[model samples]
Target chain A: MTGPLLPDLDRPKAFAAPWEAQAFALVVKLHERGLFEWPEFAARLSAEIHAHPDQPYYVSWHEAAVELLVDKGLMEAGAFLDQARAVVRFRASDHHHVARLTPIAVDPARAG
Target chain B: MAGQHDDHDHDDHSHGDHSHEGHDHDHFHRIHSEEVDALLMSIADIEISARVKALEELLTQKGLVDPSALDAVVDLYENQIGPKNGARVIARAWADPVYKAWLLADPNAAIADLGFAGAQGENMVALENTADVHNVVVCTLCSCYPWPVLGLPPVWYKSMPYRTRIVRDPRSVLAEFGTVLPDSTEIRVWDSNSEVRYLVVPRRPEGTEGLDEAALAALVSRDSMIGVTEALSPEPA
Candidate 1:
């Protein structure tokens, strides 16, 4: 409250997407569980943001979480990178193109 | 969970999109395959679920994180705590005139008396919406919100568009949210910071004069508490 004030922004909602919420929840839970302190997380997040200036804010947050997890030795760097790659591959090769189908009406008359 | 190696080169894409235009340091550059680039793009664009699931599994497997504990935290925000807590406070203020006076005079102590004091709500300020005055809350720098009373913020509240545009043009922003106030009604926006957070106590809607405190509390919406919209009028029972 005492620092230089930032311009007031319209806070329409808390989370823009599910990933943002997950990222937020992960950070808070990790802090609560003593994985890292809030200030540490904030510093990592600031560093992440500094590194990737153009990326969305939450993406930077996600990267910071990854970096902190790796730095703390709580998560393996190679394993995380591998998992991230695997997830990317899964989406690219198997999941991405699956078309969503609308539910078929049980009765023709019921179909609108 | 360590030894299996995929022949794919994961190290190539270590530097995804580091535009070092402002920085004057020479950083190592790694050559990336087109396939790896495409995969990274997909992960960044639309595969957040996959990435999140993978991260969660990795942490859980390492015994560093507990899934139930994470769920408990999310559930606490999503359910146990929320604007309903704020609604109760607002309803009490509306029901009791002396309490309303006290709330306006000293919101921090008033809110704590109602058992809604902790975390981001350590310093509280209640802005009352009257016939000619409306109050809205926003945090421009980061999403510093009243967690004790309002729970986790919605996605849009922390968005870049909202953060940049709200102060410059609040009426337009409120209009986008379908909140059209009269020109005669002066709009006041409260900027929330780490030290002080704000709660908008909307004017009680007309009708339902016989409604009890519980009923009044039930009518309070999260948007109304944020001052984006007004409380809903009573529906025919």
Candidate 2:
């Protein structure tokens, strides 16, 4: 018996994950704000595609935005990554996360 | 094991031994037993997602970014702009001969005239499919699609397989997409770049000459405008 004709697809959002949606929106928003040009993002994205051809399009696209942000000196590489680690920890441990909408305990680590 | 986080208002959905010390990360306090596994994203997706989320929160806190503006961008792409815009264009081209000629001659102005223009869609070239010829568009280097009309391209469209294969042997590629055309039809594959985006105006399906623009627009699927498939034929009378 066949499982189904077509692969199951999520109908709502284009990106694979919720973060991809935010990442996409952020890059477009940043470009609109003139922090960097579309071509600048495009160039980085093109290079990223070549660098990691196997990775998903948006994953590379997200990295391209991060690299561009760091390149333009608008964002610091170290702090940004550190915050990302903090966020991962926060999401996992914090009870008030999207998993539970109760008043969040800012995990002092992430708060600062 | 589940009693550690008794502080949270566990709504009595159900519970499991989901919260052990090492696995504290699965802090879905009140979630059902069945939902625990479903709620946990793949480790890779979770990592990248967390990183991007971190970037967004940090930027917002620094006042370097406006959360509302990000909201606006997501909302626009998610809802307002998509292939429906392109379908309308294709439908117009089919219904109005004058617009078809104008779209073929100058797509940017013709497309922008319909208010579907900006960003990746600023430079537009409308490729028309005819009885003797067929047109298909691809961005070989990356997923450079026409956003205003096509919206964000589908997952398969951006995949390496589709990008590489579509250009090499479009007939086989189109066949895989269930777009079988006659052997006599000349298939033209157009490579899209950042400079110029291509929107294929598929041949209108036979019958239903009486159908108005809105009805015709409804028949134009996203893939049809992309040239991967032909427009849907009107249902039996």
Candidate 3:
């Protein structure tokens, strides 16, 4: 129980992506702030993993934190859902902008 | 109701339920079950920063949590504490034969002597890597790492793929990380099943006779301490 559910020897990088580090920090910070206890968070995480076994672990942690906040009445359910939609929209646009990057073509007529 | 959305892929796992029509966010699909809802939202590819930011703002406004105090905690782990502490331990062991003997004999006490003992590191065993043998650490049940020395566990360490693959074929796993050992060398994989944590002390690289303990510590990489790689050799001046 103390160790992970699966055991592998592959040495992982400290942070595979930036968002992962953010997710990790967010949970640690929330735990330190007394928003929820470790056992409570772990239980919620377990429930989340049980519900959806394919999702990443930190994603489960993120979802569990949000669910805990809503269940505890700390966050308005409606508002949090709205925020999540808005975030998806924002990220989609951000991804689009990065994905469509192209070099600017110089116009000969405008060249000094 | 729980398994109803199981057929749907997680990316588009939203459900259309018109229960609270008066709220005016009709496009917002609400799943009443907390676990299912959270699972859906997590796989929806929602921006983590945005979600965490919104949560922090709401909690701060409601006086449920403090933003600055939360930042302080993040700053402590991300910056102030990490593998450097473990590097220092490795360097000391390399310099003093007596300390190395003590570290091999009793890791918990020796690690505490240097003031790096608490939480997940309460019980520990040091595995020394020699020319003929190498040691690597893994936690099959969960990511139970030696936090005091190595800092937070890496993302892949807690990942399901790593948890499942490393135990079965350690040589191939190490090879994926660009660590190819000699056929004569033996690979020992340590399963951190109980409270007892394991730390890999890599053999000191050659051609560093003139370097001091501090410099030697600088050569130690996080991967070396994890036993997947070896310390870097000293650079020519």
The regions of model 1 sitting more than 4 angstroms off are A1-74, A77-112, B1-83
Query: For candidate 3, what is the DockQ?
Result: 0.06
lDDT tens digits by residue: candidate 3, A32-85: 667777778778878887787786665566688888877987777778766555
lDDT of 2 by residue, B6-110 (tens): 111110100121221112235444555334434433323334655666688778777778866665565566543354688888889999999999999999888
Lowest-sum lDDT 10-residue window in model 2 chain B? B6-15
* Candidate 1 lDDT score at position B83: 43
Q: What is the interface RMSD of candidate 3, in Å?
A: 19.0
Stronger candidate by lDDT (1 vs 3): 1
- In candidate 1 chain B, what residue range of length 10 has the lowest lDDT sum? B19-28
lDDT of every model, 2 decimals: 0.60, 0.64, 0.58
Question: What residue pairs clash in candidate 2, if any at all?
Answer: none
lDDT for A11 in candidate 3 is 16
TM-score of each: 0.50, 0.50, 0.50
Evaluate candidate 1 and give its CAPRI docking class based on DockQ: incorrect
* lDDT for residue B137 in candidate 1, whole number 0-100: 79
